[model samples]
Target: MDKSYDPFKYSSDSLEDVAEQISDVLKCPITIEDVNHRLLAYSTHSDSTDPARISTIIGRRVPEKVIHSLWKDGTIPALLKSQEPIHVKNIKEVGLGNRVAISIWKNNEVLGFIWAQEINKSLTSNELDLLKKAANAVQNKLLYLQKGKMKKEEREQEFFWKLLTGNTLRHDDMADGFYQLNKTMPPIYSVVLFRFTKPITEKMEKQLNYLLETTQLVHICLVTIDYNELILLVSPKEEQPLNQIKQFLRVMEKQMMQRYNIEHFAMSIGGIYSDISSVHIAYKEALAVLKVKERYLSDAEHLMSFSELGIYQYLDVLAEKRKHNRSPNYPLSQLEKYDNEHHSNLIETLETFIDSDSNVKTAAKQLNVHVNTLNYRLKRIQEITGLDLKNVNEKFSILLEIKIRNMGL
Candidate 1:
């Protein structure tokens, strides 16, 4: 091959022809992949090759472990940042051989990658320079593909808004829209939301997209951005979408913190559903969870789904109804009034006793007092309020009232 001749000087109709041309020039195997590591094309090679490339060619996507290894080893971060050809050392654990790769880029965004596997010798400095030129040429090749993707994203965003707003006419249309844009209507999915401390910038949005595209934990069907909210329609990559959603949240959180030192964000999800029409409900539930977190920031910090809210789900209604009442229904007023006069913890004792389900020993342990002393406090509480500790209904009502007061209702 003449060093003066550019392998990618002329245009090809498809990436496969380009890959073959690169392989023929460099005297090594070549593979082409999209930004997400989905195999777009690979050249026919009879030379020594690694299992990772073989698996990727067969599966049509890079295996999860190889992607993980690249991320962990800083190979992916280098590829994302640099335009020059990168030399990656062999990683035997994932069956990844030595390779020279370069990111195909447009306007500072990576469009795809071209990898040249080293079968025998290392890529010469000239070969690396040639690889960079090929990446530049491939950028032009990918321009048409990228424009098509951007147009498709515009359409998907419109349909996502319709799904969330319940503006669509029927489930069939919803399924058809999903099939058209995202390839398949997911069997099960959940609405997940992440609210940042501030409005997301274009740069942050790009980072989020990179993170989402690179993750294999969830099948992200649709994504849209509000002022500060990153909304997603996601289904499981493995099984049981609920747990998968939580796992994805954790991954996103870790990535954001590691990459950008981003700390101010909260994530939540709605109940998983099979029907595409129920996206509106899921979106609402996810919003409700975020609202609940804002109100009860400490208590609901670990709340992942609306169903997990349990009794807190309806607390607003109960609080509202109590707002109009003229008198306290479970008036612990006597206990309150007695504690104020004597400077005793009688109200605390009473609340603890109720919380413990009238279990004297448990309440005593919680209050850091002896069982006999707790019995004495219980006696005093019953005497002061004329309360019967044995009545289950009364105790339950008192607990509910206590919650309402604690919430400042």
Candidate 2:
């Protein structure tokens, strides 16, 4: 059983404190309104230090003009009702100057709104990011405070676990959790895992975000690992028909390769799974499919599932690999040296043979190389590396070595 949260508790006070901080950073005035559109609290840059200005609006109803302006326009109110954050660019129509307003919500429940006025100038990317972070923090603080008031941690956890087990929806509780977590996540979602022909970069981070936003799938949660891979949690509503998640990933791959000038970015997508806990499983499957994608895809787009490959049993290993900083063992220098120096076609040969399960005939046919030439190169590989193909352990090591090499490690 959960205890009810007290409105007069310190948690609510802490939320107000956070809201004040957000108002300061965004350089805008804030008016936190209740569901009835009554002003619960208000803070302004000019009088934030003055407790009187903050208290003046406590019992007052929000101005009719502000309500009309926010709701009459439809977008912000709709976003508030939907519990999704809304960013309005040209908010000057309401006498607030050009601005971006982020609605604060909990479980699709409209708690209040935060208006970040772009009065002085256009917000730089960094500033915008900072504003977003601050706003989200305020929202998170409020959510925890609200939950504290309801004494609902046990109920929330039970509901969340049930959501995962499919025993119940408890959508109200689940939505509350999602709303709180969203503040700490990316604005768009995709189920993408990164592989390093090279380590991750800020450019990759920004690019991933851009892809989600441009795709118009807002409410994304991105988990980044140290090795430059990312896992995206995307909203289904933004997903397009005929544009499967795989295709969307492919488009991202193409853009990263061609437009961003990143030639070797590898992305694998597990087919979409709607349940929240299944996200981890989906990401693992995507990583597994990605390991094979490089050799087989040959292009920007490739989608495969571990189950489809009958490698579902190895899903745990794949999941471990998806963790950041676990680079493929073969160094990029060695792979490049082999690819660039040996007309031996050693790099392609290794990738293809491993992908084809060390089948000489199949590897040769796929590479369009004579069987004799393939065998000769395999001999050279043994001579150079002191490894025998007939040895199962050595074969596994060699296959992994080849993967490391091709990953440009």
Candidate 3:
């Protein structure tokens, strides 16, 4: 070890530069790797390198064989449990020479590892002390990087929140914000709203983050609206946007249920919009779908999409209009009056008929009534509403009226 070498003097240097300085001071080759075994940096000196180190450096990942060997020898477990530097002699069985390694820690969290290889001779106590100092330097570097990353993510999350809530509307400003975050605004985007039956746990949040990071979608932005609601904005990397969105939702739903043990949840997806500035339009649609699911489709278990809302979507629109005294022209009120007077389910029967694809037998089975009884009720509904069941326009009008009535419009 160089007695006069000050590890602090190289504080401003890059990880690779720090590794080089450490290698020179310790008289051995050095490598820095993240917790996932991804190579971060390595010394240039390679006089006595092994195939494993060379391959790891070239691939930027430690190979599975080396990882398995390290695990089998209990080196990985020891490294993870220890804050002090560890010396491994005769690593030749694992296709490597003697080496010293230490886990980089910040606040007791293992961030990465520093490895010093002993090529020509064994590392002495002084060299081990120098390696430990290098580990501390790596720890500081990781801390700085982690803090920088967290700050960047915070800014991005804030931007996403504002954009989704309609606070930031200008196209140029939105684009600039994305640029600052080093993210590209996708040409087409959609929003998905998730509602949990219970408050989210820290483990659930970590799982959500992992899911988002591993998903195939491009340009994803996830933000928690509250303890029970989460919003995701994403663009499909594939060509079939709608299909891809559905597939993604299905996978997420299954994973949440099976992996996280979440039994009850709902996911609502919005229509895709082509312009980035219109993301709030999608956001609003997603919220509407969630509201519609909770109020109208309570039996719907996991997934709902804006496109699947059908007449209910128009009902929501009509609802807004009705609030302003522009009520929709539907004659379901006459049926409602008749049903209330007769204590009948005429409106439900009509809805079941439509929902069953106009199949009388299927509608009868769904309503748990005989075919003749369902036929008689349909005839009564037609007579009361003056709608012909055989007429397409009349059937559609009845369906729309039923939807409006269901929405209490």
**The best candidate in terms of TM-score:** 1
TM-score of each: 0.87, 0.33, 0.62
TM-score rank order: 1, 3, 2
lDDT of 2 by residue, 1-409 (tens): 1223222233234645655765665566655543435444555555222232233264265443444455546654465454434555443444334545555665545545554545455656555555545454556655655566345534434443443344544545445666664333222233556576777776565545444534432333433344666555544444452145556656666656654577766666564555454544555667667766654454213344444545323433544564554653443335446657764466667668766788999999999989999998778666655666677776765555554433433
Residue-level lDDT tens digits of model 1 in 1-409: 4667676878588989889888887889999888878888899987478999999899898888898888889998999999888889989999999988899999878989998999988888888878877887788778887789789988998999999988985989997887787578888888999999999999898789878877888888999999999999998854666888888999899989887677899888998898889999999999999988888777568888878876578779999998888787635776677879999988677778886767888999999999999998888877777777788877777767766766786
A best-first ranking of the candidates according to their lDDT comes to 1, 3, 2
**Residue 111, candidate 2: C-alpha displacement in angstroms:** 28
Q: Please provide the root mean square deviation of candidate 3 (C-alpha atoms, Å).
A: 8.0
Point to the candidate with the largest lDDT.
1
lDDT of 3 by residue, 73-152 (tens): 77776887898888776556557767888998887567789888878788787777777777877887887776886798
Model 2, runs deviating above 4 Å: 1-175, 181-190, 217-225, 237-243, 294-409
Candidate that beats the other on TM-score, 2 or 3, i.e. the better one? 3
lDDT at position 291, candidate 3: 81
What is candidate 1's CA lDDT for residue 184?
Answer: 88
lDDT agreement with native, every candidate: 0.85, 0.53, 0.77
lDDT of 1: 0.85
What C-alpha lDDT does candidate 2 achieve relative to the native structure? 0.53
